[model samples]
Target chain A: MSDIVTAAMLVIGDEILSGRTKDRNIGHLAEMMTAIGIDLKEVRIVADDEDAIVEALNAIRARYTYVFTTGGIGPTHDDITADAVAKAFGLPCEHDERAYAMLAENYAERGMDFTEARKRMARMPRGAVHIDNPVSIAPGFRIENVHVMAGVPSIFQAMLDNVVPGLKTGTRLISVSIHCPAGEGTIGGPLGEIQKQHPDTIIGSYPKYLDGKFWTELVVRARTPEALAPAEEAVRQMVARLTDSAAAI
Target chain B: MSDIVTAAMLVIGDEILSGRTKDRNIGHLAEMMTAIGIDLKEVRIVADDEDAIVEALNAIRARYTYVFTTGGIGPTHDDITADAVAKAFGLPCEHDERAYAMLAENYAERGMDFTEARKRMARMPRGAVHIDNPVSIAPGFRIENVHVMAGVPSIFQAMLDNVVPGLKTGTRLISVSIHCPAGEGTIGGPLGEIQKQHPDTIIGSYPKYLDGKFWTELVVRARTPEALAPAEEAVRQMVARLTDSAAAI
Candidate 1:
């Protein structure tokens, strides 16, 4: 088995906190991280305050293998992610010539003058590498372990596509989900015993209320299929026994 | 102006971090808090691990006036939130008689046995106040400043509705939104100046990409209409001027 690569996400925007805008980036990033064999351990959403951004960034960056941030990178006064990231690393935030040229040329090609606000998108922490944004011309940047992307869902996704190929990923976690037509209360005790028997697997019981009845979806995940199979079988047996007992009643 | 009441949310569940379940609670809580005159400052989504939950709960609970948590209160081994919250407060977790009676009667009404797993739902920290769960009979609990609720959206909302009437809230913040047909680059500079002039108000510029063109929505928020009006007007004027110039060109 490969070593685990853990990550954390920092979503920076006041619009999200105010509920004016619903966040699409967190789920997308979480799905992408899971698909790419990285464990997304934690996620944080904070307003676009520099102090808040710097504090969250510093706290998570030191703990995780990679840190992904979305939002606060636009051409506005509230867009202070670049400066906050710089402060987190105690490095200088300066305009990157490559990023500036990319935006400058794109705007010029569209017969629009690149204003100073537009130029703000080019700033990055020192020793950063630009992550290309295909949806928009502005580039995201990777400084050390932190990758800062745009808040726009399309742009954030596009930038992540560019960054993924370069990352060192772990082995994909294998998962098997079983639908148990019983509530958590009915299945919890035996499920706990199943979990103990398969110590290498992670078993989670998600309860759902549907059509005036409660049910659960049991998911068994492990670093390898070898570790996952026995757990999956045990869960299925437990579900079958529970359902049989209910049917008898 | 009334004193600000701040809050942070701690979302606990492995399903959320695994991307198997998309969170609806964060946005709902944010909007509700905004409407009820509470400042929702920060949000953290963590897995169902006990140490992770305790660490995050301890960190945010100390900083905010109130901390609201969702998930991991179910009747399963993975449902470790009550234990973690108890540990965070350095209090012993024990079974509460009131909660036990509620669930025992709920199951009895349905002609079902109150199994051991079902009884697990009655556990709570010492000195915790029960938060009524109208949807499901199992009760959520509040210990000091932390309000713990179920992860299900419907149940979480119901539990919060019960808790809100008793909370000390701040003065409601008024918001004015203006849609700008121009991109952030066109309105950012002037918007910054408007924000500086109206230091008492908060101006947020949200960029949206639609129909292959970029536009912006500017929201100005303040504790009163008196502080919100001038900033809102300034943003409107900036958008109007920017659009006129683009049209002329």
Candidate 2:
């Protein structure tokens, strides 16, 4: 396994494209991946089209260590993600006997009829391992490096919580942040020098305007607390330098 | 003048890719475009890499009616959206005289020194027009169909509010939603029939698991309120039929 694990998120839904629903999965996944030391490299939102999903899955899965997809795994006409994933991997998709049994039991527990539409949830790509859905009995699945998940924030989150613990992890992430009312260019050179000095730390600067004055919030993250302290100190010194430079100008 | 007014979003930042930031701009732009009758066909989140931004800009600008980009318009070293935009359009990027004047006045009002880094905020691609920034003096710009705005939610939102009023709107969006405790497959056929019957309305189904039970929320959207009613009724009838069928099962 590579020292640095990377992942990409694919959000599939026409509802998202039409703006009928706001997507909450990206934020949830980003935070989760960060906690587990997996670097999330890119995110793409596409319609519920099979061609789009297949294209995105093929592109991202080949590039990243893991590819997580959300939405379009439901018992609906538009729920084509399973088919797309199967097509992407060139795998066979059929109703898994195990998944169907679990769905039947779940439906019986709720005193609901397991209609043919509901049965659609049991269809899984051949050779895929089922992901436990604690909130809903309809299991998500993992085939090759791709993890298929539901789009609902709460359920998706729960499913991710279940799935992440099983994956290999690197060092835990640690971070520190500082704020200054100076533009980035004022600190750019110094910041670049500090980054050069601390190659292990990731330094990010976000600029914002508060009370009609420009300000920036700088954050430094590292794999260890030891590596983070020097980065934080370097950032603090750079911010101070920038502040002084601003005052002098 | 095109019958189909299309738009694409350019999200610029490494923070988003690094999992340091979860973007909310795409959903915001998607909703805004739908409401104003502009079709938001594609969205791409590129890192703050100049070459990548230029490549994405060249690809999307030629295909869409409008391109709105969010992020990287900050006063940071990595915030190179303006430079990349200028490069993409093959135009010289220089400090806009009007924007520089406005920013100078803004800094003077707060008794702050307008450093050279702060002057970077005034830079725009040649022949670009400034979009008013009610929140800050870092004005966004519109060069042809491409509108570049800030990435921060509050600032992006304010910039959009100001920019939207000046654009031409073709239709007002109206929507109707109904919740049914039935799976989508049960309703998929009926939903398809309804869509066939009313070709004007867009009917979508979102399946969710709430309180440990499966349910689908069906929505109908159209240009007119009257069209919404018929679509809504059709969905209702479809749901009723599905429920009846499930009961028989």
Candidate 3:
């Protein structure tokens, strides 16, 4: 028996859509999820509107094992992710004492007022568990399987550390790369057959055009490294044959 | 009357989800769409699976005026975007004579065979119009409101240039920015009220933490510069009042 855990990231922000901010959270989450053996199946970026965020959260969280959302958790009118997450689950949001205490202490230490806007950071959906934030005192939270994290890279990454250890691991994928100088047209037919045979595995062909010449990087992936040997051999042999035929012609 | 046009982008690739390749297409599309007055509303990254592509295409194309897809139109077994597009629209795909001629001649000039894999690039959904590719002979195609382009950055950018000119123009938004070294908690309440007053305009507050200090940049956006005078004055006055009160306290 095997377990495969899948995840999806919902990036909530108007800045990202407007081209004002380049997203670092999705790529970072992609790399981190892959490293931890969780398959990141999909990523959707929506504007910082409440209904949009709520709709996206409901759709993606239902499809994947875990859902992580970045952005719109800060202390501003634009930061509406928390409210959206609450509305998505039909849960009432209230001031969380632990989060309030943490933020109040941080604000006191900095000799700043714990203003009403700052208080917004302390609100959490009912029955949700709080996530730790090492960067700032304001914390993210977890409701069901969905984890809400800060949009800022430093805080989001810090909060992710808290969420990762609790997730179940799956079979780590093994990758085999073959750099073929042959264009995709020369290899596409045989490659399709290989993919059909290894239906359980993932075969991806990335075409590259550099140095005024075209080439392809063939990537074969599966759960087990030991099982990839034969498939890898098939790909290598196929590429070799294709390259030779092109030369002869 | 404000001609408001909205668009969405579908990034088709397994590489992006696997973190093997960071997406450049989304950011580039975001920048271009924003500059040309088309509001880039939603962006989704999906794997190269046909069902996933079709689902994403149908969902997004129905919501926005235009939908632009990048990747999966290449000379490889994994390149199935054309087939997916055809399935989504219930149209037959065929080898476009114009696309075939362009690719065949390009390959002939390079002394390469017009292999079946290369021929795959010429296939388009029925009734689709071709978009030119200045870098390579493989052309992108437009069917209904959806435009499908190559995943490679250079080629994707080239195809985008051709598709963008044909899109409907909207009332270009005018933006006004004011940087205040006040925490969002100190200004979010007032800003929300300001936003309520100018319901026609879009107000975004971006918070920043620099040099051990808190600051925020308030951005006001509206279609007409003349109409923005009152809303902008109110925002400037609010920020000034908030700044003054904090200083007095």
Local accuracy of candidate 2 as per-residue lDDT tens digits, B1-249 = 345577778888877775667787788888888888887766777778799799878978998778899998766566789999999999999999999999899878877767676788899998899988887768999999899999988889999988998876657657888888775645765676787788888778887666755578888888778888888888887767766776532
> In candidate 3, what are the lDDT values of residues B91-169, reduced to their tens digit?
9989999899999998888787788888999999988999999887789999999999989898899899988888897
lDDT of 2 at B15: 74
Q: Candidate 3 — what's its lDDT?
A: 0.87
User: Across residues B45-110, which tens digit of lDDT does each residue of candidate 1 receive?
Assistant: 999999999999999999999999999999999999999999999999989999999999998888
Root-mean-square deviation of Cα positions for candidate 1 versus the true structure, in angstroms: 1.4
Model 1's CAPRI class is medium
User: For chain B alone, what TM-score does every candidate structure achieve against the true structure?
Assistant: 0.97, 0.91, 0.93
**For each candidate, C-alpha RMSD in Å?**
1.4, 3.4, 2.3
The alpha-carbon deviation from the true structure for residue B49 of candidate 1, after best TM-score superposition, in angstroms, is 0.8
Error of 3 at A7 (Å): 0.8
Per-residue lDDT tens digits of candidate 1, residues A1-249?
Answer: 448999999999998888889999899888888898899999999999999999999999999999999999999999999999999999999999998998899988888878888899999998999898888888899998999999999999999999999999988888988999989998889899989999999999999997678889999999988999889999998888887886412
Worst 10 residues of 1 chain A by lDDT: A240-249
Number of the candidate with higher TM-score, 2 or 3: 3
What does the i-RMS of model 3 come to? 2.1
Clashes of each: 0, 0, 1
**How do the predictions measure up, each by TM-score?**
0.98, 0.87, 0.94
Clashing residue pairs, backbone N/CA/C < 3 A, model 1: none
Evaluate all candidate structures by whole-model CA lDDT and list the values in order. Answer: 0.91, 0.81, 0.87
